[model samples]
Target: MRLSHKLLRDAALFLILISMPVYYLAFTYSLKESSKSRELIVTRQLTSFQNTLKEALWNGDSPYTRQIVSTLGNIEGVSSVVLYDDKMEKIQESNSPSKRIPFSHDMYKELESNQVKQIKTKSEGSFLVSLITKKTDQGLEKLGIIKIDIHYNDLIKSAHARSRTMLAVLLGIFILIFFIQFLYLREFLIKPLSDFEKAISEMNVYADIKLKEDPNHVFEIANLTKTFNHMGEELKNSAGIINQQQMQMINVSKMSALGEMASGVAHEINNPLMITTGFLERIQKAVQNDPEKYSEIAMHTEKALKGTQRVAKIVKGLRSFARNGSKDPMQEVETEKIISETLELCFERFKYGEIQLEITKTVSGKIICRESQISQVLLNLLNNAYDAVTEMPSKNKWVKVEVADSADQNKILIYITDCGPGIPKDIASKILEPFFTTKETGKGTGLGLSISVGIVEEHGGKLYLDHGHDNTRFVLELPRA
Candidate 1:
């Protein structure tokens, strides 16, 4: 349960726990008060009846006594009235003979005063009892005894009515207390925690931590907020440190790749330079032998310029790859353009008669990325593919590269395969680990796949070996711009 609900429940229970005796005491007091009021009413009526009886009996007026007895029987709350002689035998009763009322002898034993006294008093029972007395020369005369049954049904009904009122008042108090408690808890406690929860959910790892402080927050929750703010600051700092370390690692991997690509890039450039030198020599000779043959000279100049352009292209591709690309912000770049530019550095692989290279490009779109880092990743994978084909004994000795715009709108896929069985299932899991190369010790740095994995993931993409391919194929997936 929520804290607010639990608090409300406990508060209600506590009010009940504390109020039980109070409710019971109030109920009891109501009954007692009703009894006292009823006794007062009956006593007043009894007193007046006793005076009337004294006058009537002293005159020995039989009709007046009969009239008094009959009037008493008809009085409200008086059930029956009975009269007795001084010897304690029944003399007369107000109730009819057919409706006989039994008078208990135990009432005299239960009385607080002597039953034979001149003017003794007793309590209400099935009958009310009193002594009829008159003035004498020396003392009050003992006349006779009278018993009347006084009904107190109104007393009980009044007590019940008072009890119900008391119950309603107590119940109102309980509900009011519970509602006030809920309001207090929701305003001061639950709202602050909910705000804290929302703040935590919206928190960013890279941003500076600054939690809002509420002046009305509970003391305990304020302390918790302070602690979390401190922790958030620590995390932000840690994220900065981690990013710095990652940049350093990326740089180290790039330099390692550049060192490995240096030989191939130089060889590719050297071939173009040599071809340009031969074409320039032909242009010079043709110009020296026949100045009139302007077409031949112009044609030779064009051929020489083309070779030089080839060398310039190789040098440009290498320079772009060598530069640190981490400083560059992400922007849209042609996917085909980067692939073709990166391929220039690998031309040395195909220059030799031993290796056959095939390229396929069905991809068409722009991708947002840091270009130099993407190129390094491509270079790393391409170099791995080249090395795989080189080590294979099969005469096919080919490296195949395919880049495709994925069927899904969000992605682009690149596959690099060589004429060899795909990576074994056992160590496929470990191939991305840094420094876990299968190649000969001096030939492979082992950081290639690891760095490639990091670079691709940094772009919110992935690099993995596709075991479904018939050959050793590295699959690279990038988000389409």
Candidate 2:
């Protein structure tokens, strides 16, 4: 799931995998130690038996030999006892129908060599026995081997049971410790980290910085959380500062554009004002003439008034278009009407520059957008296309605007295609970014595409450059109303 949890789980599994072999090794070592202890005990018991037999043999009595055998046989974990001579002949053997003694030449050789020997044999069950002899003080030279056989199966069974019990206890302890640590980690680490992660993920870069505090967490996690919170605060503050700077830049750019358009707006207003003033003077002159001519003069004056009004409207539109602000409210506007109006506004520039415009309206539906804003968007695209085509030396230079309905019939798609050197693949993605323009200084404000993008997004639409085709196509897809 999460990185920390995965790491913790992997660590736990690794510990278990690593501990298994160690546990087995410990069990094997414990069994070996137990076997060695059993061997030592058997050796000591056989040594004592040998001493008893030596004492009996030095007494020079056969009855004492039988007595020694009787006493040795009564020893627990001892199956049978045998007394052997120096000639390798059994001198006295404690005969029991239920018990069998395993005596071999190796046993006698070991006794003569004064070495303790343990031999295991499989009969009714696995058996381990030791053989040895001791010297007598009477010099009778009693070369008697004391034999003690033990059930190897019983010893092994006991060892296995003890090992299993030990392993079970060790495992229980390990589990308990692991769970306790897990609880501690969860309480002091995991919960705090989770809270910190959630806070960081929900943090807004544009909004005020807010840090969540976790006093219950461990020192390391709390410190990390504090560090991340500080980073988020710094980022938020920086973003706000950058946003203010950008707003100021946009305002400055808008002022510059308005300054440049001031002369054109003045000319527009002067022409209308002059016409209106002239029409009023004419009306005054006609009023003094024939009464019939007064009616015609009034109509002509009305026509002049309409012309003046149209010029005033154009100036107002220009002023509004150059203003920089947040997007206007969306409305249902005809795509073809917006395109035509934008072209009409820029018709003078195109005529003066001798740029050809090919406008194609394939769809005649209403698109959800602001009419003035969408007109500005189209104007920007057309203007950019005009500049691009004029810069190229191609004989067939034209800017084409095509409008069509989306395949789903739920949206309208506008494509502005230019027959000029297409934009390079490297810089395509940066084209819509604010202040990113390839135009020469003083020729562009670089806010056209960026503002256009904002307008498109405000209308719940998308504006993108389509470079897959041969021509540079700026596509605008707006939802249908």
Q: Candidate 2 lDDT, tens digit per residue, 53-95?
A: 5666656567987887767666555666666655656677664
* Cα lDDT listed for each candidate: 0.73, 0.70
List TM-scores for all candidates, in order.
Answer: 0.45, 0.46
Please name the candidate that would achieve the greatest lDDT relative to the true structure: 1
Candidate 1 local accuracy as lDDT? 0.73
* Model 2 stretches with alpha carbons more than 4 Å out: 1-52, 55-63, 95-107, 110-143, 207-209, 215-220, 253-481
For candidate 2, the clash count comes to 0
Lowest-sum lDDT 10-residue window in model 2? 123-132
Taking all chains together, the TM-score of candidate 1 against the true structure is 0.45
The candidate maximizing TM-score is 2
Error of 2 at 342 (Å): 34
lDDT of 1 by residue, 271-320 (tens): 76877778687777767767688777778687777767777777777767
Clashing residue pairs in candidate 2 (N, C-alpha, C atoms within 3 angstroms): none
Candidate 1 clashing pairs? 128-148
